[model samples]
Target: MNKSEILNTIHELLKNIAPEMDPTLLGQEENIREALNIDSYDALQFIVALCEKLKIDIPEQDYGKTATIKSLLTYLEKKII
Candidate 1:
């Protein structure tokens, strides 16, 4: 998948965890968990959703690499392509 597709997938997964979240207002450098005010469990749920939906593996150690919108997109782009 491409970056746009990856971003859309991220938005979809994020909505599942925080329905109130507005993807448009999310900054590329913003922290997703903090933006959505979600807890660790919710964060993991989002990550798991991304992994399952994208059919990619994001090990626990690399979770930090996905801390922001840009980072996650960058990370996903690399993995997806």
Candidate 2:
């Protein structure tokens, strides 16, 4: 999938997980935590959901390296497809 597709999928997932999150405000360079007001548990939940939905096992530390939407999409693109 392309970057925009990946981002849109993740954005929808985030919206589903946290309705308060505004996906439109999330830019390629925005940190998930700071941009979405998510905590560690929230991130973990998102990771789990992603794994279940996308059928990929992303390491917990992966999120640490994926501080932005673009980086996260890049990581998923590599690990998933």
Candidate 3:
């Protein structure tokens, strides 16, 4: 999928995880955990949800590389490509 599509999917996943979160308030480069107040458990849930929904396997070692929306986008883009 394209970057826009990937971003949209991520937004949807985030919304499912944090209904109170305002998508517009999410900074592309900001750390999602800090920005959304997501704890480690919630972050793990998000990653699992993303993997299930997108059919992608995000290695545990690479989780830190996707700390922000921009980084996640780049990671997914590379995987998709």
Candidate 4:
């Protein structure tokens, strides 16, 4: 998938996980959990959702790379490519 596709998928996944969150309001450089008021469980669910939808594996040790939207985009872009 392309960058835009990956980002849209991420936004969709986040919206499914937290319906109240406005994905557009999430800062690329800010922590998603804090920015969206999502708890740890939701964060983990987000990761799992991405993994399932994108058909990619996100090892626990690499979860930190997804802390922000920019970081997650970078990670997914590399992985998807």
Compose the digit string of candidate 2's lDDT tens values, residues 1-81.
Answer: 676777778888899867976876877787877878888888888888888877888876676756788788888899766
How far does residue 62 in candidate 2 sit from its true spot (Å)? 1.8
Question: Residue 22 in candidate 2 has what lDDT?
Answer: 85
After TM-score superposition, what is the CA distance of residue 64 in candidate 4 from its true location, in Å?
Answer: 0.3
Q: Tell me how candidate 4 scores on lDDT.
A: 0.90
CA lDDT, every prediction? 0.86, 0.79, 0.88, 0.90
Q: Could you give candidate 1's per-residue lDDT for residues 17-75 as a string of tens digits?
A: 89987865899999888988989999898888888888889999999998999998888
**lDDT of candidate 4 over 33-67, digit per residue (tens):** 88888898989999999999999999999999999
**Ten-residue stretch with the least lDDT total in model 4:** 18-27
Select the stronger candidate by TM-score from 2 and 3.
Answer: 3
Higher TM-score: candidate 3 or 4?
Answer: 4
lDDT comparing candidate 1 with the true structure: 0.86
- RMSD (Å) per prediction: 0.8, 1.6, 1.0, 0.8
Choose the strongest candidate by lDDT: 4
Error of 2 at 71 (Å): 0.4
lDDT (10s digit) by residue, model 3, range 1-81: 778999998989888878898755788899998888888998999999999888989999999977998899999989886
Question: Which candidate model has the greater lDDT, 1 or 3?
Answer: 3
Worst lDDT run of 10 residues, candidate 2, spans 59-68
| Better lDDT candidate (1, 2) | 1
What value does the lDDT take at residue 64 in candidate 4?
Answer: 96
Candidate 3 lands at a TM-score of 0.93
